[model samples]
Target: MERTARIDTAPADAPLPDGLPDLAHLLDGMPGQSRRQDPQARVAPPAAAAEAAPAAQDRLRPVRPWRLLPTRLLPTPRATPFTFAYAVVLAVTSLVATYADPAVVQALQQGSSTDVAHLVRHPVLVLVGSALWIAGGVLSPYTLGFLLVLTALERRVGGLRAAGVFLCGHVLATLATEVPVGVAVATGQLPDTSLHRLDYGISFGVAAGVGALAGLLTPWLRWPLLAWVALIVGQDLLSSYDPLTSWGHAIALTIGIATWPRLRRAVSRTRH
Candidate 1:
């Protein structure tokens, strides 16, 4: 009889022979096969993918230095309403000071001056008027400081609070300095002319804004700013060019510092 070849096949569930490799294991190592089996390899949800797209685009975009300069130098009406409106008023007054007749300018300044005489006669009017005209017009350092500092302060604490801080400094410092002059005049210690001296500007308010803004800044920036202000005011005090005004600046700065505790709490509440 002829010998026939014998054939055997393993069942589907049967284990492979010892010398053979697993076909299933080989298939699982493939890119497509592995992705199907792995949960993390699945595509992200639509919402997540949408969220990531903008961030990726932002990362790839190049920065333009020219575009950033104007934003830094100027205040926007929506973001800093108080500063923008006040700046417009200041600009108008500055133009008036520059173009108006010398006699007219002098008369306006005299009327606006928060001197003891004006304060006593029309406390409300002079106090409000004095702040309208910058002493050295729009080109003054204080005007620039008022723009930058008040804008920054308003951004942090809001327009109303910023206005309050400015007014507090302006009104209080004026009263603090002029009240003493008034007492001296009444006591016969100073000449009557001292009561009517030309004293009108935003310097006191700006000084206070600097002090208040310092409190909100990081310690590194805060201390240096305070030092610089102190140095400038100190030098002015030493020079004795306008001792009363310098003293008023110092007092206004102190008032701003005094508001730090309250300001911090308000800021914390707003954040929460």
Candidate 2:
């Protein structure tokens, strides 16, 4: 008959499977063959303790920097109340100009010089009128209420960039409309004069500015804006070639596309 007895060397303080001998008790007992440590047994580290090292390393590592800083700086961050007020004033003046002496307005609409020029002969009024036109016609009404838009954009991208965007779009639209119409009329394919006295006061004003904004903000929209301008110009050329109806918008768009970069720089400088 043979007998096998094993002694577990567990600590008294440790939770045991049944009551077992502590390390102190085991050390005091016989170092028996049945109590010998197994060679295959591994002293495994605690899972939570093992996981903590990587977590601490991750916390110490540097994070990636943001790449979109330039784009974020494109617009000014603050709102400007003055710009909105300016837009409203321009809108009111534009309506007044249209309503006051509808006959005189007819000439302005025709894009020609006649009695209206005689009436607006005063240099100050002319200056004022021109300013008004820039605000009401060229910027606000014509450019899709971009005068107001420019303010918001300026607060984000800055005023100079906003102004550049407005100017470029307006000027480009104007050129696109004017150039082909003038050529067609000169060639005698179209009438000598049609709606001569009028000008495209607003026409593609807002649309052109929007197009410029699209160009600046989203590159993909640039092609569509350009196509729209081309189509409008082509239609104007095909038709009577009137400046008011088409040429002005063409001109505005041309200027906008060409001068946008310069305007942006100018705005940046001004802010600085």
Among the numbered candidates, top lDDT falls to: 1
TM-score, prediction 1: 0.80
Instruction: Quote the positional error of residue 74 for candidate 2 in Å.
Output: 18
Candidate 2 Cα errors over 4 Å, as ranges: 1-83, 94-156, 164-196, 200-208, 263-272
lDDT of each: 0.88, 0.50
Model 1, range 179-226, lDDT digits (tens) per residue? 999999999999999989999999999898899999999999999999
Residue 103 in candidate 2, Cα distance off native in Å: 5.7
Candidate 1 runs further than 4 Å off: 1-55, 62-66
lDDT of 2 by residue, 103-188 (tens): 77654433322112322344233222333443244334444445534544556455555555554454444445445556676678
Cα lDDT, model 1, residue 49: 89
Candidate 1: residue 184 lDDT (0-100): 97
